[model samples]
Target chain A: MTYIIKGDGSKEKYDEKKLAKSLKRAGADKHTIEQIKALVRKKIYNGMTTKELFGLAFREFRKLQPIVAPKYDLKGALYRFGRSGFPFEALIERILVFQGFECRRNVTSHGKAVTHEIDVKAKKGSQVLMVECKHKSKEHLTIHIQTPLYVYARFLDVKKEFTKPMLATNTKFSGHSTRYAKSVGLRLLGWSYPKDDSLQSNIEKYKAYPITMLRGITPDLLERCIKKEVLLLSDIHGKSPEQLATLLGIAFQKAKKIAEQCKVCELK
Target chain B: MTYIIKGDGSKEKYDEKKLAKSLKRAGADKHTIEQIKALVRKKIYNGMTTKELFGLAFREFRKLQPIVAPKYDLKGALYRFGRSGFPFEALIERILVFQGFECRRNVTSHGKAVTHEIDVKAKKGSQVLMVECKHKSKEHLTIHIQTPLYVYARFLDVKKEFTKPMLATNTKFSGHSTRYAKSVGLRLLGWSYPKDDSLQSNIEKYKAYPITMLRGITPDLLERCIKKEVLLLSDIHGKSPEQLATLLGIAFQKAKKIAEQCKVCELK
Candidate 1:
């Protein structure tokens, strides 16, 4: 899983639960998430890289974000990455997907007269984490003030079932900004570079959060475990010649030979 | 300006003129180049970065390439950089604009059945240059084979006024492919890393070639020159008053006073 520090110097895993929560928080409806999922699944192919998936999700989300914005100006702002912000969104999404979460990029909420879009949405089990990712230089940390405003817009669109709002940024938050988030009951997931010990702890803490908050088995974790198993099995299959390996620590060829004999006996 | 080495292990400058020639050779119509120049000029704003302008022109040219392809695709191929072969037709236009060339990124012909577009048209003295650009990886070179084919299709559309063909790649070309291009008389511009001095010389040799048969410009010189200028200006702008005084061989107070004067005079 890709890991990043949250705005409050906490390490957070970019997982499916986090993505779902983020989407819900960003005001995406269940229908929208399902639509996005369908689009991503259809586009997916074998040996697909994480970056490719993120890009696909991003393009899909971009189409949706405009539909949710309140005004054309707001829609423009969401689409505008101002250079550096462009690649950062994809990187964040990739991290989340790697950590075992299902994520969609550029989610938009369509309303009667107004629309809103979130950068990413991650869902795992019942916990739906909404993330607002910012990639500003350290000197521009003061820009954190705008983060909540964007998050609040998303918060209004989230379904009632999800818990907790989180903001993620590559830049550290100012003390004043942290205090404001705390007062407002918003979770700040911040990370400091050069080996941030605090971030590591936050990941561990969040991992233990009650699973009931998540819908079911975290899709992100399940995917990761499955991928790992597939990789291990493929490695074994490469070395072993037998269809069935022996229970004992025998050579793969011997196991395959035994399996073939067993198959012959069964055939007879 | 981005510089790159050619396939023959030579360094080359990404000259706007060379790009223009490639576009002309690709069979782009004069009207297309004119339209592109106007568009770029109209959309340009103060403090616009080179990369931003390139993207703007690329988008514009993407809208026009299909229209002029009947006569221009062969020469236009040299401007593409990436795998998608989406026309970066505005690259030369942007380069020229950066160098004070009066070029525009405008639309020429619109596709009725296809949504694809072309970028811009360029004029140097009496000559008009039509271009498209591709930004691609070396591993994905095959992705661009269809580009020439598309240009060929466009050639058929316009009644064959444009006759030049050009192909540019940031990655190295395969020997078999190079031989194929040579056999067919297609101009292939392959670019690689620019740090090598020998490669740079080869690029220079290609640069000296007439636009009629030239493939593409080297990305190394263009990128280096732009980088040097940007870096120098950034450093100069970041200096403290005291530092400026030392550099100018003047007293700190006097230097501050002069700096203020220079700022007022727009001389800094």
Candidate 2:
């Protein structure tokens, strides 16, 4: 079995089966799978990291399926959010708003007894949900029972004055946690939980992908745009590339490249 | 089969097995159980409610065991706490202190982003826990799954700015709920969960029994004492009958009767 280097410089077996599964999940056809497998075989080596392999695969995957490629790759890119010294929680606020939920991030509410500091509070119709976002860079780490318990416990203190409690993680939840949370009625939205209502599904459904997901934009530049209320890539459409470059202090060419990527985010 | 009315005015078949179990749990010997059973049988009528039956059994049960009787009966008296307009969360704050925890209730902390209204934030050594206390007037009602979910969701919002979250209920937790809470690692202190360390057990352990649990004190009189910083029956010990009546505006005879009950609360 050939091994691939990880972000932490550790080695692990490169499982073809895992790749095939991810590809299938992205709606790649049999012909495309076979073509991608050939490209992987041609490119991978003993010391190559999984990040390099993802870049190679993503390039080939994009050729086979353009629309699905970015969504699939964006899912991978999201895992990097943990590293950016950014208020990704704010980005999440924008996405929830796009999904038609009235959302506020980093808010303080004066309840009858104490003031509550909320990360993200979203309300849709009569339903209000308070979300705890756990962002992990590594996919292998699972959110165990501790998170739900802590969240539930906090919510209990202020439940009479606040919204419903939920746990959202970049990675998946442990089986035991999911079972426990469901039994307690704690809502969970992980990478793949709630099936069609996972984080990826919510982002895809709204087509309101965060500006940080774009290739050329750094977290600092993105924050400036966010401060100016330009949250989604689609929000960049009305601006000229020259103005975008000047406003964000990026090169004209880089700004144009980011604008090009935002074009694909336009929904019906 | 005989039927009895519940608090909701609903009728159900009287189950002697349940009564036997409760009697057994309260440390009743076999002879005492038989005596209580005989009395329950003699008092049977067409329209008697469960509350009436409890009174009949309690009077006899106390004769058999005085110390255990107060503790057991204290569990029953707690259900009436919800009816009093007094802030019982303050009582919970005192209980935590007796358990070797530093507790503050109805506290507001100004965090970096928002002000937090904390019901009870308790600290033991380096560990700090935020508690949500659910006060109930009926023993039949259990803290269900929706509670933890709401608690957890609210925690998700403010966890970043607060301490660890926990849930405490005046009554028992449902079987599914206990199992779920354990799985998720949420520290729970319902009337009878974590058996040895349950909310009821904690009250018993610390001798932090509520003043309302005194045999003759009414909720009205108790609320008045609570207003005067007299929370526990033990707190009643230092006051003379005359002073107690003067402080709370009750009759001298009623104050003497309350003083009589306070004698049993002398901690070991």
Candidate 3:
């Protein structure tokens, strides 16, 4: 057992098996994983932040396979999500699933006055949440405050069993919107709204890393992988190089490269 | 001299020349116009309302031409706007032109955070208005209250020359939306919003009827006409039947029928 400092300054005993599992989930190869495991065992000491540990592993991982370095860079990889034409609703649904909620996507329900096309309807016991995803191509756009009001109106219109309406956007939100959300009791999750519960925070909590965040994966290849329904890093992490090549219709070498780097990419 | 009662119960002497000019504007035939005039003269009385006069003329207009009746039915014809893939912004611009406002269409402007695509910008001296048209296919959809808020945010982002923003929609707006619009000072012109200043009122006030509202025109034919930029009812009102047939590449009878009907359809 190794004591490692976390981002929040809390220290926890790190298990090698957990590290290896996450690395495998990240798509690291057997040889790379063994190398990273040996390195972690040798260098890891008390008071070393997980950030430092991640940097150490990332450096070694990059040296072994530079093509997959970005796949391991969580924050940078999340930003790269803006470039892909992936289904955002699926990402949100997966996060809801990770949160132990049942989700029905693209539901059409009749309102009192007008029918609504809900993007996702999540349910658990008597509590229900309707989530709206506003995906924009550009990073500069922000969700205005009225979105909460608009979303809330729709929620009231068709509140059959839902507890409340929550809006999720890939971009940030305005100050007005955050205040409006609080006032109207509309749950909002954006790039940066409701600082405690944002889209970024949800992704972090769920660990739903986008496959496009990987360095070796070009948008064209990512699109092909998405076509094959391999949307996230974990979706393709467990697959063998040969299987990946066959499924993604790429070369064995490229697939192996992707698979190997992804497996040991996580230092923690 | 025959006196006619008006909508407000005021009396005015009916002028035959004024009647003939309005008939021509409504796309009526000369023979039909003459017949209607004769009927109006035969039926005129001091207590006869202008509504009664209009009804008498409409009955005669319908008898002379059944196909063109809907085109003259302003409200019903406006509803037909949903059928054709007509460029609505252009129609709105034409209305603005009649309102004596100079316009520029689809102008792009850079804001502090992001660039915005302005739909239509109308300018008159020191006063300028940025207009956004929200065209929906379904009649049931209402512009939510947040739209005013959303639009106002965009307006604030890029307020180059336009001092005010106006949102126009083909459908109705939510009660909350109307209240919000009033609160925020965002001018809204929907099917029945800003009751004194609505899209319906604008259409009536400007006499800017869409070319697609013509009865002799099919959606396919209207598409072709729109492609040729013949968007308003008055665009081809001056063209001869043969010229219209030649220009539109349709049969002589069809063009003649359209030309004949459009000439007097404006007799209000």
- Cα shift from native, residue A262, model 3 (Å): 22
* Residue B16 shift from truth in candidate 1, angstroms: 41
| DockQ-best of 1 and 2 | 2
Docking tier of model 1: it is incorrect
**Which digits, one per residue and each the tens of the lDDT, describe model 3 over residues A49-127?**
8888888888887777664455456544554554543467778788888888899988987765455678899987887
| C-alpha-based local distance difference test score of model 3 | 0.72
Model 2 Cα shift for residue B189 (angstroms): 1.0
**Candidate 2 chain B, run of 10 with poorest lDDT:** B109-118
lDDT of 1 by residue, B1-268 (tens): 4443454445554444554554454344566566656665676554554445455555555467543232222222233231233223333343434434455554454322222233444455654433334455333354233343333233222213223333444455555344434433444544532233221123232221111111222344224323333111122344567875666454687545433322211211
Write candidate 2's Cα lDDT for A67-151 as tens digits: 4566557665576564543345755776677778888776665533334566788899887887767777766788875577656
Q: Give per-residue CA lDDT, model 2, range B26-107, as digits (tens).
A: 6687998999998898887867898898888888988886555666587766776646533467667887788788887766
Candidate 3 interface RMSD (Å):
8.3
Top of the candidates by TM-score: 3
Best by DockQ: 3
